[model samples]
Target: MSDSTKQVTEHEVINYLKEHPEFFINNPGLLQQLTIGNPQGDVVSLADRKMLQLQTKNQQLAKQMKQLIANAQRSEGLMDRLFQLLTDLSMNAPKGEFVSALVGFIQKDFASDYFKLYLGDIKLSDDEVCVHYHSAQLKTLFASFNNNDAPLAGRLPAVKLKALFGDESAAQSAIVLPIGAKAAHGLLAFGSKDDQKFHPDHASDVLQKLAQILAVFFDSQAVNDGQQSQS
Candidate 1:
């Protein structure tokens, strides 16, 4: 072929490839045709194939990410419904039934298998009902803290909670939340077993609000209980 007729560079071959819509990459014979005209054609064709493959892979990954996001959104919606149900139950339920509902809701939603709502003592040692809730598997975990122990004094980190509770233990994770002001009567221990389910930093703004509402509800319950006692 004449010097002018010969393909000189990979860029020129790439341009030629752009112009050729009929080229189908099926066999070694076609590949050879592309590479023989100029060695640059082989490099250009390989580079083109790599770029195309990367783009296709990225598109697939994007689809998977979208699906994951959608699934997460649905899960969050379900959780919202459950929280709303708990609030409704607390408001309309009979006094004893309301407390049972709150406990059952935590056990079901948090998947702790066992948990307790303790009132009148934020200091853990001051109360045994709360401790017994985790009695089957974690009695020793609280040996270090007592009612005399100040709040936040011996708090366990998320990782430590998981280790002590056992990854598979039905009540493996616990969160100690002091509701209301220091004068408030109680602390709530929210526990669960799934390691990835509850983190120390998990968002609980909604739960905090729920606790606030529960504090009010319990306060009202206490007055009624006192009235009955006097009667």
Candidate 2:
């Protein structure tokens, strides 16, 4: 017989035993007598070897499916918790807490690790927005840009904001969203350690809604501030 016809390896033998355990399972007489105890005869056959491999593959596939299901359920639960937290922040939090909640929303809801919240002077003549708040983590990561040097200092090209933010490999991606009651009054920027998180093609509805809410809140706050200043 050719080399291919030779007896298989020990790993194949063990694998065969696992596949069709029924082969020996039903025949207790042969199962007990065919082991190393009676290794004189042909212990395991080629058919048994193939069956074992198939069984092993099937078991592995089942394990993978189980893991996938568990992960899906976990993700769903996390989303539910996140939604609840955001709802509470929006409806019941104080004005000072709004910026913190906004940054938290970007980080937790969208998986962004770095973000900025710019609150423009509604009373200013130009469309000027300044970084009034930002994530503490982002402050640490890019300390140089936190203060007056924040992206708010320079006028940026709307078309190229993505390229500018994504250049530093570490900055990953960014977004510039306008916040205002009627027109845009502020901007929200998000960056990531993973470069793909904030691509220009990423969806904007969620962020847009966030900007709108913030604009309304800020405008209201500005009115309150003016009243207090006159008082």
Which stretches in model 2 have alpha-carbon errors above 4 Å?
1-94, 121-169, 181-184, 193-195, 226-231
Clashing pairs in 1: 125-146, 125-147
For lDDT, the strongest prediction is 2
Per-residue lDDT over 33-58 for candidate 2, one digit per residue giving the tens place of the 0 to 100 score: 44332245645644565566699999
Q: Which ten residues in a row have the lowest lDDT in candidate 1?
A: 130-139
Model 1 lDDT on a 0 to 1 scale = 0.54
The 10-residue segment of model 2 with minimum total lDDT is: 122-131
What global local distance difference test value does model 2 have?
0.56
Best by TM-score: 1
